[model samples]
Target: MELYVRLNDSTDKDYAFQLPENATVNSHIKAIFSTSAARIKQRVALSDLMVIRPSIFHEYEPVEYYKSTHPGHLTEGGCLIFDYKADRKEYLEKLDYEKPLIDQLWPGQLIVPQWRMSKKYVAIYVAIMAAWLYTDLPDCISPTPGICITNQLSRMLIPILEKWGVQADLVNKLREEITPNYNSVAAQWAFFGLHVLKVLFTTFFFYIAMANPFSFNPIKMYKIRNVAITQKNEKIQALLKYLGWIGARRATYDDYQTNYYDYIIKKFGGVVQAYRAGAIKRAAAPGVPLGAGEGFQTPLEERFTGNTFKRIDEENPKFILSEEYFCELENNLKELLDEADGNIGRMNAEIRRFRRYGIYEPSEKLKHVVDVRKEIYIKDKEIAEAGKTADKKRD
Candidate 1:
């Protein structure tokens, strides 16, 4: 039987196996781990398979290793992480108690309150007011009076007020307060302070109005959040694919990773490709020369002597190869090519879809190159129907 494995890490590293009658998913994992290079201290049964991690168990718990193991931190390879183990029956019972609507209220999903928005706006406004207090007075008035000083000051003040949207009417209002004969330093400071207050109050009022819950519609913000979560859900689906849990439908990671394009492409895609290539070569052609450049001798020399093909005949020279054997191999190759093409077609379709609506804007594109492999998931109902139809035909 073949079991397809996908990882929460979004890797699809599946393999076919000749299992004992009672082999379990846990046992299959252990068998794989025993031969792997990963330094796994514990088996974290994430969903259905044991995986490597040294410390953290559940999402509720903080990933303590992050502080020490952060790439920029003091540590080299980072701290170890662990997976949580669940008593299956108990865990299932607990999950059953959760309400449907309750499940929907994930963190970062809720609409932030209007009061919080208003408070933030007010805090920033206050900080700006504090800065304005330190800046020099607008030079509309004179500490010492002269024609040259007044004209120089007027030139500077006019541009500043115009840029700030303070009109000539506002200047006239200020000018009328001063005596035509003389201007004092105190009066200039008072005018500057009044202008600062006017700007602050006007801006704050605009912010408060925009942030009020009644006036502010959450629909746009909610759509952004919804899109984010939808992308997360796609990642979860891809992870299921990586762990080898077959889905109701078959689509390439390119089809799903449009949501979490970076993680899927950089993190998961490489892992899945390595696993698939390793598994296929290991199981299918353990002793076969992969290719001419793969450290094997010249193909011409290998064909007659030191080659997998030659060795097979040496082990059983009495067996004779006929037309039937070559025909079968040819058919198998054709089937493989057909499957490869199908996989490419699906991926191309997904790419086109994403190009039209892919929102990985302001980020790098995901590199999820498509490839084909034997799909092991067939619907049980479909299988049963086919079996019954075959039996009827035989009868």
Candidate 2:
């Protein structure tokens, strides 16, 4: 059998070899070394050999490499991609995944323009991220977060960015933004005012960066983290995504599968309340609830607390056999879950505030939210203070 074994390296060269059709993967490794000693000067052990289908990128998921062979896994006359574990370990150490996608791509998979990864350009992106993160630092330092002006005056600045090699996503935002309260006369004025200021500042900075690139460059001025930062920062959006109600697949909190999990949890108050009542307990054995005469008797006693597993005592996962019980539990669960609805309504103002004003802190914006009470604390305090003032006036 002849197989084209391609090395996923900068060379992008494929090693061709002829061997028995039934040869094992170990033999293939030896063949690769024997075929080309020029490239792989070091011996690649069978344990270290990684084999995959032809891939354009590593996250094309080289993670899904074939370690063991079964029928239909590898085929005769097919091209196979291979990399040594040691070489890949060194290769991976040099990549900064937090950087933009193009910067992080493998050298063999994508060729990046040297200017794009240049110190000046990378620093500009880094500053954009930092400014977008710590938005409370001062407006004079960073562009206002969500105020993208779609007016013709702002449209002119978009080209300045495009000319200076700014990313497409940031540039497009200038053309497409709609101020939230366009219906309100005051909001419209305020929106345009910020838009004008942002446009002037952005256009001048970019033009200077283009003209006197060496002088305007941030890289020359300061020592920064090695990782290249990305723009319009996704952290704020991700925080919203985690807490949003109409659940889509949540990329932010992946452990729970989806944002629906957040809805399920927060709707029920907190962790303890979420699973305590009507959780459809899997019947302790799916589709098989303990019979009336089986497992334990009716009117079971409460079990011990604080332990991860219960040793003894009884709590029925479901009614032994009663529609009445399920109906009652469902009604109760609905009432129990509805308590958090007020929490949802109260968050609307603050969440809306966050979108318009940007976040005060990077950590604050991205912090994982367990309950809704945290953000609405300001409203709670205001109500309490009003109550106190009313009491004083009565006295």
Q: How do the residues 300-369 of candidate 2 rate in per-residue lDDT, one tens digit apiece?
A: 1221222111211135222121223223323433443454476766445433322222121112111111
Clashes of 1: 16
For each candidate, the alpha-carbon lDDT, in order, equals 0.31, 0.31
What are the per-model C-alpha RMSD values against the true structure? 24.5, 25.6
TM-score of 2: 0.16
TM-score per model over all chains: 0.17, 0.16
Candidate 2 regions exceeding 4 Å error are 4-68, 73-395
Q: Give lDDT: candidate 2, residue 223.
A: 27
